[model samples]
Target: MGANFNLKTLTVALAALSAASIASAAGLDRSGQDITAFLQDGVYAEAVYTYLDADVSGYDNAYVGADKNAYQQGNKIDDIAESYDFFRYGVKADINDTFSVGVLYDEPFGAAADYSGDNNFVAQGDRDATINAISGGEVKDFASAANIVGKIQDKVENGGTLTAIEQAQLKKLGPAVAVAQADYNMEGEGTNVEVRTENITAILGAKFGENKEFQVYGGPVAQRVQADVKLRGTAYQAANGYTMNINAGQDYGWLAGIAYSKPEIALKAALTYRSEIDHNLNVSEIFPALAGAIPAAATGMNGEIDITTPKSVNFDFQTGINPTMLATAKVRWVPWSDFEIVPPLYNTGSKADPTNGPDGLSLVSYDKDQWLVELGLAKRLTPALAVTGNIGWDSGAGNPVTSLGPIEGYYSAGLGAKYNLTENWAISAGGKYLWFGDAKGQIPNKFAVSNFEDNDGFALGVKLSYQAKQNFN
Candidate 1:
């Protein structure tokens, strides 16, 4: 029993490590464009390198306490605490002094979680029960354990026959089995819950007046999104279980934004707005060996998943209090309500019948509209060097419910420095820390359960640039 416990602990740790590695491998968006006014000029070209690291810890009770064989061990999972790093490079240039264009290449979104493996710490009976539920009896000879347990419970409630030994076993195994099954189904048959998105955007800005005090900028933006979705564990049969590998596809989308800034009166303010984009993704499924039971309708499953990324508006203001001192403030409004994931052409009839069809139809939804505020101060230490520090707060989305999303609100603080290597060249480096708030969600099953947790992380960034002397009148 002691050896068993040790092995179980090790298994859980491995599982958690695998999950964290998966989550961090995608290397999505780590930092936004620098808010410094000096980099906004049309005649300069800049390149930036950013590193983002995060430690995510949370429980997903989406199916908690639902299965007869499910168990809960403090809602702790193996791969909850993980870290990720991202690297990005971008370039901006001025064309003919009136038009400015820039391009950015980076990973914008990614997710990773793993629960299917032989080393899983869950007990054999509990794992088997959850697998049966998710496989939908696709496996032969499994006896549909969940169904059997449900029937047994119903019989007991109605005063059915049960020997003393049977009664004792049921009482001893019920809760643990149920919780373990819930965890298994969640790790195996639950939603793929992971995503990886890579995006590239091109921007253009223009100045109207010769003095260049006033300007208007807008441009077309395009992105290519790739999604790798996994099938739930319950969808697989043990003897001849169905195996669905990662589903990957690319979609094209576009956006546009406009901004204006003025810098003469020791005061500057700019407003920018961006639009949303949509993706129609195509998905395919692969079957496992020995399951020759492919129905005629299963020949070539083709479908689309619609995704609308969010849009946002940004406001930035700055003032010079002294020759070498400056203060700045920024605010952003993001339309989270518009965020949604809708699968195309769901078979409602098939979903209604668990015995003869696929998993039920469901869509990904979130109430995520939010606001971000930031304040910073900068000081020029010498003719060739300057440093700045800032703090920021992000309000939680009105509705903070998600199966795999870890936290809702965040607090961040950062420091940055710039050094002029030459009259026309400069370099900058910075780092930031983020604190995330806890979040909770429920899993739909016979037993409605809840899961909650929190997360946090840090980010580092560097920039290199070359600038031309200002052609001021």
Candidate 2:
């Protein structure tokens, strides 16, 4: 191979192979936080959009019988995974041959899951099935208690007075009556959770080598996060009516990286590190079912919840396999095990129990860090057209994951194509299919509540990009 090879033309063909990507993985990671746009030869800009849809269903855990002595599998849970989408934009320019600056915007982290159907994950008017499953059939007849309470209410509302005997009965059955009424009031409700986050990063880089083959870059990143959660159904027991609203919060972080390139071989490599961003969000929580035990939970409390998105490292590399073919690889690591979300009031109430002590439970936490690897190949079929294919694997955050997002990890395959409308403009499209790993769903305190298996999903993306060529010599 000669250094005289048309590197600029090759760059255009290979760039599309990396254009429209879907890196849907564990621990709320989306978009893959790609920064390749900054590495292009000259002035480059791109806009990308990605959409993901998943089908996640499972079986709820239940008591073996009225005795509730052992756990058993219960009703079929409906699909909880919701379709999600996000956008990304990046632009970079050489401020001369030695200095370069760029900015990237993306939605980097998020989750969405909603549950419904006749499973324990939903609340119904009768609630008899829910109670039986949750209580091991011991509290057999909720209808009888409901009837007695209803009669007392009817008499009082009709301008009648309660007899002494009736009053005594009311006192004895008051707690049970309250629970039934609460369940009734929440008829047809289901558990749901949604979280969203965004990031904007700015970078300044300097090329140093005699041939300008080496570069170092560093910059600041700003991020915003928000979330909403609702827990319903007997599946949650005392926490059944729990709800949390976290207002949007913005914070800053840093990014640094080093890169190397060889225009002769059309080769490039980069190692990037992103610092964790912390957001102190205003949070409001209501735990209706825990009202009596935790008065603050029932009345709702407002406080601050500190959430730090995990730090990560990414290695991206690509090289020409031949004149018309390019090989690419990506490896990413995220310390998901160190990430957790804990609500102040919830933690305090949990610690009120001697067994829980000071290290109370978190609303969400992962058991392990995540590792993801992807490999791909792209071929320029024509001067204006190129196609690419890739395979990937993700080591999930861990098994027995949060019931809110129960997936372990995924294996995926994808295909993409790019078409150049002109020498400086291109459009790309890609699609990926993911096979999700089976996992047990868990709640706070490491309690397993459901089993999900054989779930799958797909992602689609499109990108429009522009680039102006430059000589690497």
- Top lDDT model: 2
Q: Candidate 1 — worst ten consecutive residues by lDDT sum?
A: 13-22
Q: Rate the local accuracy (lDDT) of all candidates.
A: 0.47, 0.81
- TM-scores of the candidates are 0.67, 0.88
| Candidate 1 lDDT tens digits, 188-212 | 3433445555666666667666665
lDDT over C-alpha atoms for residue 12 of model 2? 56
Q: 144-241 in candidate 2: lDDT tens per residue?
A: 65677679878988999999977755543434444455666888888999999999999999999888899999999999999999877777654566
Best-matching candidate per TM-score: 2
